[model samples]
Every structure is written in structure tokens, then in C-alpha cells.
Target: MTTATATTQAPAPAGAAAGGNTLAGTRTLIRFNLRRDRVRLPVWILALFLGTLATAGNYKELYADPKDRAGVVETMDSPAGLAMSGPRHYLDDYNFGSMLGHQMLGFMAVLVGLMSVLIITRHTRTEEETNRAELVRSTVVGRHAHLAAALCVAVLANLVLALLLAFGLSGMGIDGIDLSGSLLYGFDHAAVGIVFAAVAAITAQITAHSRGASGMALAVIGVAYVLRAAGDVGSNGALSWLSPIGWVQRTYVYVDNRWWPLLLCLALAVLCAAAGFVLSTRRDVGAGLRATRLGRPVASDALGRPFGFALRLHRGMLIGFGAGLFLMGVMYGSILGDAEDMLQDIDEIQEALQEIGGATIAESFASMVMVIITVVAVVYVVMAALRPRAEETSGRAEPLLATGLSRTRWVGSHLAVAMTGGTVLLLLAGLGFGISGAASTGDSGLFLKLVGAALAYAPALWVTVGVAVVFFGWFPRASAAAWIVPVYAFVVGYLGQILQFPDWMNNLSPLGHVPQLPAADLSWTPLVLLTLIAAALVWLGLEGFRRRDLETN
Candidate 1:
């Protein structure tokens, strides 16, 4: 009996146990986050890296002569060029390195920042929305562990990308692109990405939904870009200093190789991250600082219908994308009036314009801009079409389906919105482009021409949405694969012209089949064929979804 006596120990109080463990499981979470993003991280990093290399190679080949390089300075010195590219100061040096810094750095930095924002939103707010963060926190995980892991993973991804960019450019052996300049260029991208990651962390605390968090962060990036663009085009360069994107652009990689601007980026990152940590302490697990908009006390009659419900869900996206595409069209059109004077001296561009078979340089440029606008509209199509899959995975679809709502009608509602909404987006874009082109060139005919050119791609856009439907119906888990349609289209439609890819390569994309309107002829044959293909794909997807099981969480 005496030997059987044993001592029992009580566990420590939770408050005491978690006092100094705000980041207790950070390392484990970081490793887990890395594993989750393994494939995605590599794809983003590789695409950006390869694209940079290809662009650099193209520039080198295009401007092999110093005199030809000087012609580029003339185009880039203008206000439109400054707004689209970077500061005009790069024109003073006008060499290979300066060209890259002036034209590529700001654009690449924005992409890098977008990458960071998505990474943070996916790992932090997305997990919380899905209720995974609640489970993670019930264990040894700390309040800040999830955000910390997200930030660490973003930092790691950016660092790897920066290293690759630095070493790869230095190894290219370009005349003016030396190691020091390359290092500055690479690290500047990393700094911009880090700052955005911190911004996302703070935004994640504000919105309970992942989409809201990512949207807020992306809006910040867009504002920064606008500020930088406006400031760069202004007489005095002081306004540029207000933007993080401009901060990195100010590094002036090959021109001045200034390192001080990087310090500003780093300081902002630290301050934002600190604020995020403080905010996390104030919010509860699986909850946002700002509560989600409360639903109506009673459901409306419209909410009962599939189409109405789908419209409600997609309303925000439609408004945001419509406004964005319209603005983008205006921006691209503003540059069209100068296409002849700007591109005539650049032999490669002239060759590309000729390849498009335009009667005039401006028409060829309009055709090129149409490709960009159509591709951007396709982004909206894919996202809207894939909304059903997101709902299913989030457990919302199961409840709606448990009622009398048929699966076909439910899915069809979303697809309808996606298809019709995309067409409307194109219409807005065309109208904006036409208005701007007519104003800029003082020719009302140019407005109608550009509008028709933009609308000509609508059939291609339908095909894109059809592709997304097929994936979502048959391979719900692999629905994201549909993005390849738009991505490939962009590569073929835009870069294919620049890199001189074979016609066969371009023809592989549905977009390639459409006539380059206002540049060449407007042929209805491809449009008819494309419309038939789109209908067939949509019908097949609906049938497949009817036969398949619901993919509810």
C-alpha cells in the first residue's frame, strides 16, 4: 500500500504558460507553410526569373548598337513613358543597366509585391476563414505563430528570388550590368515584397474573409503605383518619394546605385510588422478586428433565387474589375497616339508591328494593346467561374444544395455571371479605349476602330470561361489549372510577338485564332468557330457536374 502511493502534478495555468510564448510554434508553422507552398513558390519564382532573363536577352538583341539604344532614351524621356516606366533620370545614362532599371524594376517590384500579398493572405487570413487557425491555436501554437509563419515564408520566397535575380543577371555578362548593380536591383525587389507582406499582415487582421484582406492589400499596391506614376511624370520628382514602389525605383540600380532608398523600405516593413503583432494581440482567434458586414435580419426574396444569390456574391468583384479594366484601357490608349514617333526607331518593335500586318504603326500598336486588355479581362472570367469551387470547399455549397436548388442551376448561375460579366468588362474597356484614343489622336474613327478591336476578343474570352467550367466540373481539386488558359494566352499574344516565337506557337492559343482587328482584317470565321467550341465546352461541363459528386468540406 505504501509503495502504491504516487504523487500527482497539476499542469501550469494557461495564462502563465503562454506568457512568454507569443511565438512558441513559429518554426514548426514556418516549415508547414513552406511545405504547403512548395509548388506555388517555385512556379512564381521561376516564372519571374525566366521572364526577366528573356526580357533582358530581347533588349540586348534589339539594341545591340549604342545609337539604337539612344533612340530608346528619346521614347522613354516623354511623360507617357515616364508614367508607364520609371523616372526620367535614367535617360541621362541610357545604357543597358539603366534601361533595365528604368523600365523593368518598377514593373517587377509590383509583381513581387503582389506575390507577397497573396502569400500572406493565403497563409494567414485564408486559414482563419477556413477555421484551420482555430484548430492550430488550440494546441501549443501561439497567437502570433500563424502570422509569423506567413511573414517568414514570404521573406524566404523573396530572398530566394532576389538571390537568383542577382546572380543570374551578373552572370549574363552584359556590358553595363555589373555585379554591384545587379545586387542592388535584386535586393530592391525583395525590399518591396517585404513591405507589402507586412501590409498584408496588418490587413489580415482587419477583414475576416481572405478576399477582403487580399483586396485591401492589393488596393494599397495599386495606390502606390499610381502615386509613383503621377510623381515620376510631374516636373519635380519629390512625390515619387511617397511611394514604396518609387523608393525602390529611386535605387537607380546602374545609374546611381543608390542604397539609401532600400533603408526606407526596410524601416517601413519593420514598423508595419510591429503594428501587426500588436493588432493580433487585440483580436481573438478566428476573428477579425473589424467585424464582417452583418447580414439582413430577414432574407430577401431575391436571395432565394440562384441567379440573384450568385449576383450578390459576385457583385463586389464585378464592380472592382469593371472600374480597373476601364482605367487600364484609358491608360493604354493614351500611349497609342505616340506609338509612331516612339516605336519607329526601335527596329524590333517595327518588326513586330509589321508581323501583325497593320496598315499603319498606330493600328498595329492598338492591336497589341487589345491583346493586353483582353488577357486582363480573362482574369475576371476565371475568378468568377471558379467561385463555385471555392464555395463548395468552404462548406457553403452543401447547405445550399441540401435545399431544392438543383446542381445544374446553381453552377449555371455562376457560369452565366462569369460569361456575361466578362463581356460587359470588355465593353467598358473598349469604350474607355475609344474615348481616350479619339481624344488623344483627334480622330473619332480611331475610337470606333479600337472599340471594335477590343470587342473582337469576346469569343476568346468565352472560351476561357468554358475552360474553367470544364476543370471545375470534372476535376474540382484541379480547377486552378484553368488559369493556364489566360496565362498561356498572354504569353503567346504579348511576349510571343516580342520574342519572335513561331506562328505555330501563337496559333496554339484560342486568342491567336482571332483576327488582329484594326491591324489586319476582321474575319468572322474564327469568331463563329470559337463560339461553337465555347458552347460545346459549357454543355459538357454542365453534364459532367450533373454526374459528379459535390466536393463539400
Candidate 2:
């Protein structure tokens, strides 16, 4: 029996199987996330690839002449250019395709970072916060599945973007398309997105709430972007290389095309994701690594009021957005002197600016800046107006309504804050720009000029607020869809100009109807009409909200 006995291997323990089941439900969760983002992801992916194609195609025509190319190279290397588009050492070689890639590399990275943040927040903390995770977790789902699925979708989106960029650039028929450089360029963008996805994942674990996680992650991005801009514009390049944005730039795709630096992003992403997974395992469900502290025991009298409560909830986000716009104003103001000189000799650039906004360069600059600022306000207004939906979904609205508060009064309170906040944010942006402009020019009049210009966008802001209110009233389940209004405005205002789309297409933006102030006359007719229309929409919304039941989902 001993001689006939065969050696047998020990079976693995059941605990080992359980330990390996952390990703058990990842595929199902991924499908769920994808379904939720079906429209959103494709819209964004299409925009990314289309923007890349447009940039590649347009630059060939925009910089066909060597003289024009030289101007681009010179302007891009200058402080303003460096700040706007980081030092694209690739432009030193004067390849139009490379310059095109340089133009959008950082901005595109930012867009993807935002996308990643929103996606992760939607899945992880949001699910847990809303108790959807509880039901899902009660099943055969794994603990790590949600975060892993979100990351997987983001990575997939990035991969698609990279492939699109590579293919789009290759087929554009531009000279020196350099497939290696183009593909590497695409890879660089993907790397930046992956790093930010990891960053969002880690942030999602550290804060107990989704809003806190989003705010913290966005703050980090803001700081990193500023740091990169500082380094790019600084005399020494040391600070530039420290930023992830700068590292992406340092790759100098299409110039040296060196890929060694990309390893930095990869390493950071791996470490961040690993840290997030480890932290997630350590924390309890629906909780964070850091426990939240209790608020003050006594509430202020003002906090009892609806407007005050709305203000309190939104104040921090308002401050964050205001600070960012102010910094942007400062950057734009700093560049005015150089922008004038840089575009002075280029007839095409001057013509484009004139067609884009005002008769004079200063007026055009102010109008364009306000147009962008107005888009920011649009987002703020929409988010503010939809706050009540968040409350309703979270069951907080039930208590408030139970207190005998009228639906109209409650909804009106939120709208009031939203409309007022949008106005205040615009003022802050205007003041920031005006003060910066005045400082740059040593003229007090510029402040009034810029401030007035920003105010002209008020009607546009009101319309966005109205749109959000309408959604909140009738389609509370889809109130967040109101954000698409700003997306449309942003695309039309910026991308429409680049692609030189038809006038009818460009005029679709509410900002488009506002007369180019300071450069062109400010007409009262459109403003009055727009305001009336916005008021009508609000009236309709209030009536609907008053009649409908509070959204439970």
C-alpha cells in the first residue's frame, strides 16, 4: 500500500478563494456604470477626438506659412503663451501638427481629469451615500468592485481617446504626421487621465462624503494646474517638471518624443490606486478613512431660513469657483500686453479676434473673457438650482416639507440663491479681471470697463438658471441634465470659433446674443427679452414643482 500510494497536493483553503473574490462583481458593476454613462461617455469621447481632429486640421491652414509658424513658436515660448499652453519644446522644431498637439494637450488632460472625477464620484461615494451600495453589497457583489469598475471605464475611455487621437492625426494628411510622435502624444494624454483617475479614487476614499471628495480632488487639480503654469512661465523650468501637467509637457511629444518621463505618471497612478484600494479595505462601508466631525451644537438664526441654508450649503463651492475664475482673470490680464504685440502683425489673428468679439482688441479681449466666465456662471446656476433635488433624493426635503413649508417657498428659496449666486460670481470674476487689468495698465477706467463687460452676460446666466429650474420642477429625476446647457454653450462659444462653423450654429449660444460690450454697443432689447423669457420659465417651473410630488429617487 505504501509503494502504491501516489503523492497528492494539498487543496487551497476556502479563505484563499474568498480573499481572491474581491473583484467578483466587477464585470456586472462595470456594465452598470457603462449603462449609466452610455450617453455621457460617448459624448465626451466624441468631443475629445473631434477636438483633436479639428486642432490638427485647422493648424495646418492657420500656420501654413513659415512666417506664421514662427509667430506661433515665438508667442508660445513667451510668458503668456507658456502660461496658456505650456512650453511645448516641440514647437521649437516648427511642425504644425506638433504645435496643434501642444495647443490642447494640457487643456484636454484637464477635461479628462474632470470626467474621471465625476465618474468616480457618481459610482463610489454617491452610491454609498445614497444607500444604493447597501442593496448592491447585500448581494454577491465584492467590496472593491465599484471603484474597480469606475476605474476600468475611465481607462477604457482614455484608451479610446488615445486611439482616436492617433488615428485622427494620422489620417489628417498633414506633413510630418510622425505616427510615433502622434501615438506617444495620445499615450501622454491617456497617462495624464489615468493618473487623475487614480487621484479621484484616492480622494473618494479619504473623505466621507462625495462632495468633499470631489472638492478635494478638484482643489488638488487646481493647485497642480497653477503650479504647472507657474513653472512654465517662470525663468527656471524646475517647478514645471514637478507638476503632472508639466510632466506631460516635458514629454515634448513630436519634438524629442522622449517617453522616460511618462513613467512618473504611471508610477504615481499605480501608487495612488493601490493606496485607494488599501484604504478602502481598511474603512467601513459608507464611511471614509477620516471620520467627519460634528457641527456646532447651536444653529445660527440665519441658518433657520431657506435662503441662508442654501447659501451655507453652497458657500464653499462658490468660493472655490470664484477663486479659480479670479486666478484665470489674473492670467488673462497678465497676457494682454503680449497678446496685443503678438497679434499686432498677424492680420489673420487680428481678423479672427475681431470676428470673434469686438471692434477693438481690448473690447474683444474683455468680451471673450466674459463669455468664458459666463459659461462658468451657467454651471454654478444649474448646480445651485438643482440643490433641492439632492435634498429630496437624500430624504432631507421630506423633513423640511413636513415642517409646513410650502413647496413653492422652498423651491423659490433655492432658485433665489442660485440666481443671486450666479450674479455674485459674475461680479467676482469681473472684479478680479478688472482689478488685474487696471493693475496691468495703471488705469482705473479699465476696471469699470471690464466689470461692465462681465455684467452683460447676466441675461445668459439667468436663462441657464431658468433651464435648471424647469428640470428641477418637472423632471427632478434628471435635474442634473441641466449641466448640458453649459456644455453646449462652452462648445459653441469656443469650439465653434475654432472650427469656424456657420453663423447660425454659433448663434445658438445665449452668450452669442449679447452684444460685444465695450467693442460693440450693449443693446437693451435682447437683455430685456431674455430676462422676460427666463422669468416665464421660472414661473412655469414653480407651478409644476408646486403640483408634483417630491422626488424619492
Candidate 3:
């Protein structure tokens, strides 16, 4: 007892840094991440840059009138404005480019942030979940290197995105854009992205699985948007400070061109990433700070069945999608009241919709929003339909198939969930929109009209399901390629109306064929024919699933 000297060993190098250089392989990993994201990063950057450029270029023409400028101010100050665009930071004068920043900056920041989150998660938590992290770690890879690599790639992407925005805005030769202001605006978007990339890095360390990490990161994004919306509309400018998107707006790009906010973003990003590095060293490979909870030791009888198991697998995703869509619906619905009133100032947007869609301007606008919602719902269903392929490739379906359960029943159970879950989610979104619309107008009768409009797209959604089912059954490896269908439909259906594409190209979209309901006449011909086509595709897909061997990775 007397000889017991308290020998406190030097505190182990605070976590993963225990391995001397925690970022030993960070540069290498960054190179790999860049290669992996070459296609994806460019696509995201171009989509946002081009969209922002196009919108900005149009502002001079779109709102040249003094009255139109005032209308833009009014629209920005409206509740719908609060919900759609964060806040009007540039209310001093008609700084058209600055006004454009207020309208599009908040949402674009969100998109950029989401891209950051996905990029980080794909390289970090997703790799860990797939055991790829362990494989990498087995070599001389540093503990903090993966995260550092992910962040580096996201940062590079953000820088490129900023340059693209700056160059695009500056090159437009628009009088509204000042070089300094354009640079600020572009960098502001990049700042927002890097901050969220840091947030994703931290989030990736919290959950054991990529899905949970993604969900948490996404939840943060949603909460940020809502918070920003609340602060902007409720006259609580202080509240806006709480949100990342709000922070982006606070940058005051194109207005005073504030540089201070970028510093704040940088600080937060650095802090979060440092914390993530700490977290990386503390946890074991494949484990999280918030570890996955243990499941019941015993299985219920329902777990033994196919449909029950399928439902069990998909319930979380369906709930998440439903909730997100419902929120989207509420936001969209809140703005419909302003559709007719606001456009008196700038009716060209209205005229364009009415011209392209052959419907009343107000009704066409509402229909457009409704159809977009349906397309999102279709995306959910298509993903759901491909679950069997995911399960099969993951080796989870092998056991299920080993039992007496036929492949048809096993696969069909996922299809069943796709159908039911898709319908429920679509209806939920519709209900949210309808209820919000009615409440806003004090005309509770609008509930049915909006809900019916949403449900009307069910056949269109099923068409996507049919196509995805065919891909899953026939070309399981290329099932993810099915996402192109809805995305293509949405782009063609929505953008085509703006670009005034040929009717043939527009009609190619299944969603385009659906009558714009609640404002336009409903026809049974397209619905019936689309449903029939869906049924045939579903049969073919299932038949292909029957004939093919399991295409497990």
C-alpha cells in the first residue's frame, strides 16, 4: 500500500490524434473523394449556378417598373415571403441584384448545405456503415483523415460553386451587379456550404448508421429553415440569428456586402470540425457517440411474415418523407393567397404559366405546385419500390428467400408498401396543403379541392412505381437509374412551361398528361390509360424479377 505511487500516464493523445498524425492520409482521401464526386458535384453546382444566374438575369426585365419593385418588396415582406424566402435584408432601395439575393439566397444555401451533408455522409458515416472505413483504417489512414477529406472535398466544391456564381453574375453584364457585391454573394453561398459541411462532419460521428446520420443532418436543415422563416415573418429579426440559413442572409451580399458573416461561418465550421475530429478518435470504428439501440431479443410473429417485415423496414423512411412533404405542402399552400394579388405587379410570370399550361393563371400556378408535390411523392415511391433490390444486394433478402416464402411474395411485399406508403404520403402532403390553404382563407371548403388534386396524381406516381419496379426486377444493378424518370418528368414538366418547350416534349411527362385539377377540367382518359400502362409495367417488372437471378453486390 505504501509503495503504490500514483502513476498517471500521460493523457492519451486526446482521441484519434493518439495516432500521431490524425490526418495522415487526408490529402489522399481528398483526392479519392474528389474522384468519386466528380460527376455529382458539377451537376449540383451547375444546377444552382445556372438557376441563380437565370433568375438574376431576368430581374431587370421582370421588375423594371417602380411599381414592380415595390411589389417585390411587398411580396418579400408577406408571410408567404417569410416562408419561401427568408427575409428582405435589402429594403433600403431597389438594388435588384440584392433583392434577388434575398429571394433566392436562403433556399440556395439550403441546397448547398444539403449537398455538403450528403457528400460528407457518403464518405464518412456511409463508409463506416459499409465497413469501408474499417478497411481503410486497417492501413496507415489517420483517424481524423476521412472527415478531413470529406470536408476538403466539400470546401473545394463550395469554392468552385462560389466562383461559378461570381463569374456567372459578373459575366451577365447586368448593371445591377457590382463586382465586389457579386463576389460577396458568391462567397456567401460558399460560406453557407462549408458551415453545413462542418455540421455534417459532426453529425456523421453521432449516429452508428449512415441513414440515422443523414436523418439527423436533414432534420437540422429543416429546423434551420423553419426557424429562419419564423424570425423573418414574426418581426423577430433576432430569431433569424439562430439559423444557419439566416446567417447566410445576414451576410448582406450585394447590399453592404458584409464580410463579417463569412468570418462567423468560418469559425463555426472550424469548431464543428474540430469537435468531429475529437469524436472520431473517441469512438470505435463502426460505432457512434449515439449508438444504435438494441432491438427486442425476441421476434414477434408478424416479423416472421413478408409484408410485416417489409413495413418494418420502410416505416421510418415513409414517416420521414411524409413529414417533410407535409411541411413543404404547408409552405406552398400558405403562398397561394398571394398568387393572384402579387402578380398584378408582374403578370408575365402568370401569363407564361397560363400560356404554356392552357389553364387560368392562378389555377395553373396552384396546379404547378401540386404537380411538383406529386413528383416528389413519386420519387419516394420509386425509392420504396427498389427496397427489395437494396435488401437483396445487402444480403438481407437471402435469408428471407431461403425460407418457403416465394421470391414473388417477398418482392411483392415491398411493392405493396410502395403503393400504400406512397398513397398515404401523398394524401398527407395534400391534407397539409389543403388544410393550410383553407385556414389561411377562412374557407374550409378548399380542403377537398386540394386533397383531390393531390390524389389525382396517384396514377402518375404509380407510373413511376411501375417503371422502378421494372428496373428493380429486370436490371437490379441499374434500378437507381430509375430516379431519372421522375427527375426528368419534373424538369420537363415544370421548366418546360417556363422555357415554352414543344407540347410533344411536355406531353412526354406522365405528370404533364394529368389534368390540372381544382382549376382545370378533369379527364378520365389519361388517368385510366396511365393506370393501365402502370399495371402492365408492374407485371413486366415482377415477371422480370421472377426470371432473373439475385444481383447482389
Candidate 4:
């Protein structure tokens, strides 16, 4: 009987169970990510889609005559216009399809790329930072599951956005915007997104923090844009081929309807994603391939102070945004000298500029550019304002709260940074714009005027930060809604006149209340009022944060 007993076999370890299947839990993660992004995905998709539709519809209204289109085409053919929009070849056809492809596609693709980068970083590195990925991995998850899932989510988002644009744009019954060209345009956005998603996937593996990963990926986008701009503006069209952004633009979607450039995008995406997977395998969980630098063994005096500590945490992002704003200012200012000349031929644009009330077309353009510059600075403000919430949710706030640090002090430190840092960013942008504008226009007075124009929006910027603070204090989960302020401001304040939107709609944004400076008489009343409103909002937020229970992981 003892001899007849069978030998028992033990099951393999959980890790061993998956064997070489590094992407074992990908499907589950994709579903989980999709569920988490339901609201976010729709908002991004709808905003982009509606904005495109509105812009496309207006093209017809704005340029009904062939001469109008041809005149605009001449403007676009210039180096300044080519750098801002696309290549000179886009002017060949200049149909609604070509117009849409030239003007909107590159900008739309960059936004989509940003969307994709955020999606990947949020799902991959962000999860790791929060320790959520570790908890998931302790189960049946595989090593590459998170990365694969993130890529899948990004792909899905791009695909959906592409499909929506394709069908929606074609269905509008606009001439020259055929389904084929629309599809090409839509997929061009998706291609850029996918390429950047791969870039983010690699960046995530390199950096320890999600923000760093995002920054690295965004920097790539910036480089691509710069390269594209330089190439398009220069005599060498081949230089444009070097960048992924330039690659998509070269597709000549509406003109030639070429589809080959997508192959390059696909190749790069595959290569980058594969590298990310290999890198993931080389590193430990919750750690980056590049080790974090060793800090001073002893705590510094600044570390003891809440404001200093908060600044330390925000230093990288602040510097990055500051540099970016300055460069953007310079770029915009570079074209300032020719702005009046470019618009001189376009009667519709001239009339619109007249309505905006500038002393000159250059001045009016500078005023509008100021609004755009401020809107960008608002991005930094919102991020800085929301930093405290991130700290609170991450459980770091608990240790500090247990000490002598009060909630108000802790939160105030970051708010101070948000407010002051935003002002600094605006000042830097103003200086850069002024320097470049003066050089471009060869008018020294224009420099100070542009700088003043940039600073004029500071009150509106603070108000934007205040909205984020209010959301962070009372509705932490919905803090992202604060972004609507800037986005709305950009749309209504920048394009509202052109789109013929009602004044009431424009007034809905704080930026709308701002006097278009340099172009119009600067009024102190609205600025003062906006400042008071911002102060009140901040106080309300601090009170709410003080009263409510802190969120903890």
C-alpha cells in the first residue's frame, strides 16, 4: 500500500507561472486604465473635435472667395507663416482640405501627442510613484504589463480621436474635405500621438518621477516642433524630414494624400516601445533605470521651512516652464515685425484687428500674443496650485501635519509659489518677447510696451490660480476643472472675435475682461477687481482646506 502511493507535485510560484510572458496582465490593466480615464478621454476628445469643427466651418466663412484664399496662401507662403503653420507646399492647393491640413493639423497633432504622453505617464510611472503598480504587480501581473497597458490606452485614445475626426469632418458636407483626406488628417494626428506615446514609454523607464518622464517627453515634442519650424523656414525641405512632426506634415494629406510617412512613424514607435520594454526588464520596480542623485546627508535650513521645501519640490518644473515661456515669447516676437505686413492683404483679418482696437496692427498682434503668453503661464500656476493636493494625497502631508506644521502653512507655502512663480514666469516671458520684438521691429519703445502688456495679465493669471486652489480645497477630486479657465480664456479671448461668438461668452473668461493691452487703453479697474476676486477665492480655499479632513492614500 505504501509503495502504491503517488508522488505529489507542487504548483509553480506566482512569478514563475507567467514564465516569459512579460505582458500577462496587459488586458486587465487596459480595462482598468480605460475605466479610470472615461471622463478625461471624452473631455479631451470632445474639446479637440469641436474646436476643429468650429475652425473648419469658419474657414469657409472667412475665405469664401478664391482670391481671399490665394491672398492668405501668399501670407502662409512666407517664412514666418511657414514656421508657425507648415511647409510652403501646402499653399499649392490651398483648398479647405489643404487649409485645414496646413493650419490645424500640426497644432492638433502636438496636442494629441501631449494627450498621449500624459496618458502613458499617468498609467505607467504615476502608478509606480503612488505604489499602486507595485500592489498590482504583487498579484498575477507581469513585468511589462503596465507599460503595455499604457501604450494600449494611448493607442486606443488616438484611434478614437482619429476616427471621430475622420467621420465628423467628412460628414460636415464641406467641399474638398473628403473622407479620404479627412482620414489622412485624422490619422496624421494619431501618428504623432503614437510616436510620442513611445517616447513617453521610454522616458518613464529613464526617470524616477512621472513629472520628469512627462517633461522629457514634452521636450521631445518641443524639439520636434523646433526642428520642423527651422526646416520649413529654411531652404532645405529635407531638414523637416528629420522630425516626427515634420514627417506627418510632409504627408501632404489634402494636397498629395500621401500615406507613406506613416510608415516612419510606425517604425519609430515600435523601436522605442521595444526599447522601453527592455529597459523595464533591466530595472527594479518603482525605480528608474537612472538612479536618483544623492542629496546632502544633513537637512539644510531651507528644508526646515515649508516655503523653501515646496520650492525645492517645484524647482524642476518651474525652471522648465520658465525657459519654455521665454523661448516661446522669442519665437512669437520674431514674427511680430512682419505681422502688420502679413495681415495687410487679408481684409477680414484687418477688420477683426480694427475691431480689437490697436494703435497699429503690430500693437494689436502684440496684445493678442500677450493673451496667449499669459494663458501658457497659467498652466504653471494651475500645476503649482494643485501641488499641495498631490502632497496631501501621497501621505507625505501626514508626517508634516503630525509635527508643528499647520495645514494652512503647509498649503500656503505652495500657494505662494504658485502666485509669485507665475508672476516671475510672466515677467520672463515679457522680457523675452520685448527683446525679440524690439530687435524685429527695430523700435526700442516696443520692447517696454510688450513687457508691460505681458505683465498686464498677471491679475488674470492669479485668478486662474485661485480657481485651482478653490477646487483643491473644496473639491480635490475635481481640481482638474481649473484648467477650463485657461482653455476657455484661450478659445473665447483669442478666437472669439473671429468665430463671432457672443460678447457674453467671451466675458465668461477672466481673460476676456482684460483690456487688450498695447492695442487698447489699459484700464486699472478690471485688474484691481480681478486681484480682489483672486484674494477672496484663495481665502475661501484656505478655509475649506483647514476645515475638511485631509485626503490620504
Shift of residue 426 alpha carbon in model 3, Å: 1.6
Write down the lDDT of every candidate, Cα atoms only.
0.89, 0.80, 0.82, 0.88
RMSD in Å for candidate 2, one decimal? 4.9
Cα displacement (angstroms), candidate 2, residue 367, comes to 1.6
Model 3 lDDT per residue over 80-170, tens place? 7766875655766656777777888888888898888999999999888877888887767778888889988989999999998887898
lDDT of 2 by residue, 1-553 (tens): 3578689988644222255687768899999999999988998888888877876776776677788778767767777688888774666687865686577777887887887788888889899888888778776777788899989998888888888888778777788677888898888888888888899999999887888888888887887788888887788878877788888888888778889889999999999998889889988888988888887898888888887887888887888888877777777776655566556655655665778666457666666666777788888888888888888888889989998788888888888888888888888888888887777656677788888877888888888878888888888778878888898888787656555667897677677787766667778999898899789889988887888987676
Winner on lDDT (3 vs 4): 4
Which runs of model 1 end up more than 4 angstroms from their true locations? 1-19
Please write out the lDDT profile of model 1 over residues 319-363, one tens digit for every residue. 878988898888877877888877777787788899898877888
Ten contiguous residues minimizing lDDT sum, candidate 2: 11-20
Lowest summed-lDDT stretch of 10 residues in model 3?
A: 10-19
Q: Identify the runs in model 3 with alpha carbons over 4 angstroms from their true place.
A: 1-19, 353-362
